[model samples]
Target chain A: MEVDKGKGEAEETRKVAEADRDTVTLKSSDGKLFEVSKEAAARLSTVLAGMIAGGSIDDNGTDLKQIGSEALENVVDYCNKHANSIPSAALISSSISFNTAPFKEPEEWERKFVDRLSHDALFDLVEAANFLGMERLLDVTCHKISEMMKGKSPDQIREVFNIKNDYTKEELEEIRQELAWAFYDD
Target chain B: MGRHSRRASPLDVDDLLAEILLCLPTLPTSLPCASLVCARWRRLVTDPIFLRRFRACHWEPVGVFHTIFQSGREHLSFSFISDPPPGSILHDRFSVPARCQDAGGGDDVYTWNVRGCRHGRVLLINMPCYDRKVHQFLVWNPLACE
Candidate 1:
């Protein structure tokens, strides 16, 4: 009986240790699961880093109820891509850095990654990025949206964003006249 | 617009929407257009906090406005020319004179004369020449008009 108890205790310790596994399983609101590199998620997302450090990460699937399946999949994809592309040395060195460094333009691959996303996907990713406190991802996604807005008129912008024109005709004319230079095309 | 109807909710969050709009390349052209989207959006774009953040993100001056003193017929006209960003392929230059409707026009009291420019504000020497030198100045922000 003493030998069996000792073996059971040893097995418990091994099971607990597996919680510190290199990869973390994230569960979406739709019951979908995505496996992301634990180190990369912790490094890129402050919320994830907090969860990891707080020992709240579940070896099974950590529930991310706020994120949908598609958004979670994109998040996982981004983490994997970031881990693969960013040099390990840079990641290690930039682990604790803030926004002190100058904003670097997104790489061609990053640009293409965002460009391929549909408008809804892009919006979802931005929300996810904000929720996760992923500043770089937020910047990249915002930059892509801004690019789409380039050279677009107010009418076009309203149409694209699904925003209604609240200003009356007179009010609109007043504003347009007030900022005539801005409204004029180059 | 037709395909992506339900996707608008995510962007309805004002803070997230502001973040995306703040990423615009230049404030002059795009932001004004964005402000006209809706009342809420206009308020967000015009908010002091949002403006400060936008300025922080884009600290570099998009273009420089220089003043050229021209001896016109009646008044000493100050022509402000906008200099494009460095390495710009297009060279489009336009100038507008300093106009102060309130300031009385005469030899002693005129609109303004460009003295200098520092930190995005144009220092203008107000008329009322005392000992061949202007006594007052109007520290004006041209960009504020935008």
Candidate 2:
């Protein structure tokens, strides 16, 4: 089954003039529903895209429910905004000097963007990225994951991942001794 | 409770834990602790996955690994192998270093050699095509590429 191009072009054109667009219906696993952006529902979610493309999507201005609703919404919003926004040439040149958008010296808008999320939300986004197969999302998640790894010993990581230690005390000690140097930094 | 309802679940938390541990990346250091969690976990320690890729490095075991087969051994060949079949008669047999005298500095003697060292981290290889000689060797610690 083939979907019409881009969730109806006239609808998108009308919404560009007006903001706070009408909701796209999303169905949840337990037969729940949620209302979200048509732009977002169209662009970011491959699952949603497949539904539309396959002509399986009902989408009649109803609540769009999702199994992982918040996670789905966050991902859609991120993708939609990122897709539409143009990069600042001034920021581009300035960023090149340092090769990074300095997190410490971030713009007010950037700070507010992250401030809205909870730890659980952050984790759910990572899972969402993995589910969506988004590389940019994966990099963000991996960097977030590695950042968590920093300053943490092996035991801490295992615990964080809900991993249980299978080594005996003596064996653990022996292994620790073998990798004693790894504990120290360069 | 009735007799049928009185029985406990067949699978416990530990059983689930064992499956999780077995699914982890095989790191030699983590195996010992992971196996000790329980008998099921202990059984997973012997799984080839835990034994195979887990030994990423740290096999630089200091010892005399070779016999001095020749006084003027210039070059050799090496094969870094992880596991050889246990209790096989051919384990280290047919795998002897055959060495003979080669000219010092500016000489022509060609032979190839091969060896296994330290859970298979490094291979020390020496081959001379002109003089037709091959030498095999393995290093306890393989150095980083320059």
Candidate 2 Cα errors over 4 Å, as ranges: A1-44, A61-69, A85-116, A131-135, A158-166, A174-186, B1-124, B128-132, B137-146
| Candidate 1 structure quality by residue, lDDT tens digits, A21-108 | 8899999989999999988998888899999889888877999998999988999999899899987677766546833455668898
Model 2 lDDT tens row, A1-186: 134555577678755634344445655444555555554444445555455457565644323342367766666666555445536453233212322322222234434444577646655665556555443443444344334434334566555544456667887666555444223211
DockQ of every candidate: 0.38, 0.04
lDDT of 2 at B48: 68
Best by DockQ: 1
B26-52, model 1: which lDDT tens digit per residue?
Answer: 645567777777788888888989887
> What is the C-alpha local distance difference test score of candidate 1?
0.73
The TM-score values for the models, in the order shown, are: 0.81, 0.42
TM-score of 1: 0.81
**Cα lDDT, model 1, residue B82:** 39
Where is model 1 more than 4 Å wrong at Cα? Answer: A1-8, A98-102, A184-186, B1-3, B67-120, B125-134, B144-146
Chain A TM per prediction: 0.90, 0.53
